[model samples]
Target: MEYYSVDASGYSVKPRGVALPRSVGDVADVVRWAAQNRTPVTARGAGTGLAGGALGDGIILDTSRMDRVRYLDGVVSAGPGARLGAVARLLSGYGRILGPNPSVGPYCSVGGMVATNASGSLSLGYGSIIDNLESVTLVDGRGDVVELPSNRHYSDIISGICRRAGPFPDTTKNSCGYRLDAVPSPDMSHRVVAASEGTLGVVVGARLRTHPAPRRRALAVMRYADARSAAADCPRILECGPVSLEVVGPGIMEGYGGSCVLFAEFHDSVPERGGPDHADRVCGDVRRAAGVRPVMIREGIDRWLAGRNAALSRSLGMTGDRAPSIIEDATVPLERLPDLFDVIRELGERTGSTPVYYGHAGSGNIHVRTPADSRVTEWYLCEVMALGGTITGEHGDGMGRTGFVRRQYGEQNHMLFGLLKDAFDPHHILNPGKILPA
Candidate 1:
């Protein structure tokens, strides 16, 4: 029970009980019991989510024990319990790789990735997990086991609600509520469930498309005097065709205080590298990205990569429980990224919270964690929505941002979300109080 509560984001909810099912049949049995008893069911994976998607007060469905992997030609069939890193290791033997590799690293579960539509630094080159998803097998709220796309009956049921759905966001990634866009398209049943966060059903298995891993790789580091400078140059950097382009405060890298740095990597080979006229830059490997400073190549480079992944953890640690707002991971259009940076800085001044910023710049997905009040989240969401961005880029809306779903998509679209929730889980017995406004 201790392990069943709280996610990495520091949000905790004591569940009534936990159910660790060994097979899909067991999962269905538990969900059926919950449905009949009017109890909530929360599906969980590796618990690596930055949002509190896995925390709830009812029956916690733990799938970590269902870890299993199988090969399936162009795609791979994985139990919702399968560890993503383990799956990646297996695929590497076949010269393949999972498309959406979250910076949360290899320890996250496959189900969790699909659950949150996980995207990482490399997502700039590849899309989120939703983009690579092929199909899914799940147990509906009533405990009926079902497979998607292959299960046209369930698809038709979901499609009916989607045909009357409202507008969808124009952003690159969205994990706030039920994915209605996936409906209306018969083949997109998996996409709809992939990011639903278990509101619709309990995931049993998933089929994911794999791609050839890059044989050669190089990382480039460019230093800008400030975030604005780095943000201003992001557009030109994207033109270079690097696999990823990210921005981090100097604090993440070693001994660099008050400096803004951009880390870009190329998968095939090092592209022609250049930045601002006075930009002190390196574009060979990790160390070269640091202007070939006196840091050790292998060790320094490894630390640099680790630092980027640790951005969320670092900000969380800095809060010391005093920060009012833990808001992170928002996506705007590429052209508006510079303006986004300016707004965050202003937001920081207004809130009296230091915003630790970092993320995939090419796609305009950045994480900003500050210690402000709920108003900060509201202001940020309103601002991003005004710019045609999303409240979350990779992290799903759990306890943190679910209340803003209505304003994020407006009343009509928000109502459609409720309709889809009923379409899949009429009793609202699965993952209740998540992705839905009270």
Candidate 2:
């Protein structure tokens, strides 16, 4: 087993054992062992999760090697251990693409993405993992290998869960507690496992839905003189109904203070049938409908897809840096996105610190990376909660945000989360201290 003092960014935490499970049987063995000994286990994937969801004091189950993809009629079965990029590469051969892709694509694991219900710049077009999930197989706290969505007993449990769903946060993208909302629908059973944070059970494998590759593509690079201008145009651009419309504030652009930029991507299923002139007409129509002059439009089917992915991979160069330098994920309602600027700016002023902020403006989900100062970790957490947001949005609350869960979810919600944890893991040995109080 391998251990580290800090994760990707450098957050302070003492990771104990790094267990690499070879298969579902190995996962079950580990769970059984942990249950008997009352040992806690933390599941890890690619170590790319920014929330420290993979951080813990017990054994860390590294699921990176369990990657295996089996394609059925229209669905793909992926091992929880598979890296997201590997899966995407395989799916692309069949003209299929994964739904939600974080900028940190190649490095993240499918399980990690599912754990966080991850969304990306293209999330406006392709929803998160929950939207694409088909089913999941996991080992529950009772040492039972439960196949959700296929078990009638689980359906009854799910129905009961729906009746008791009140104490959870009501939002579009959430990774803070049990995904009870997903379990109510038959198709959403897989979603229940999508963002479980490894606390409810150890995910062995899952089935995912795939989509055909886009045919025609267009981009609208809208430049904003200020953040307000960008915010003002977001709703209008949303009305244009592009496959994906992303916003990156000046904080993300090099040396552009107070300025912001929005990247809009549109997908047309048929491009070979239309000439370049028709493409221009399509882009022009979209621009006119959006009521904003595009600074530039890069046409070409593959070119647009490549550009969107390029923007998503901008976070790959931070290896060997201090841990806390990593980004913290938090999201609010789209209407409250502009207000988040004020909250972050004020928090920085109060804490005497600054953070770089950027994200999927369409969904109001953004990632913030604080300066490399360990002294302000506690303060940054306090401000995040005071602003009526959570410590995690797409990224699950790993060790980094574990200490702040109660405050973010409030007392009532926090207790309900605890109850869900107890129901799933009575002995509290499965990834303890991840999504609930330990």
Off by over 4 Å in 1: 182-184, 269-303
lDDT of 1 by residue, 114-223 (tens): 88889888776777888888889888888998888888887776777678777777777778777777565776776888678888888899999887776555566667
> lDDT of all predictions, in order shown?
0.78, 0.68
The lDDT of model 1 is 0.78
Q: Model 2: which ten-residue window has the lowest total lDDT? A: 311-320
Worst 10 residues of 1 by lDDT: 289-298
lDDT tens string, model 2, 91-148?
8788877778787767887777777777776667767788778888888887788886
Model 2, which residues run further than 4 Å from truth?
A: 1-5, 167-170, 254-258, 270-282, 289-292, 299-326, 372-390
Error of 2 at 45 (Å): 1.4
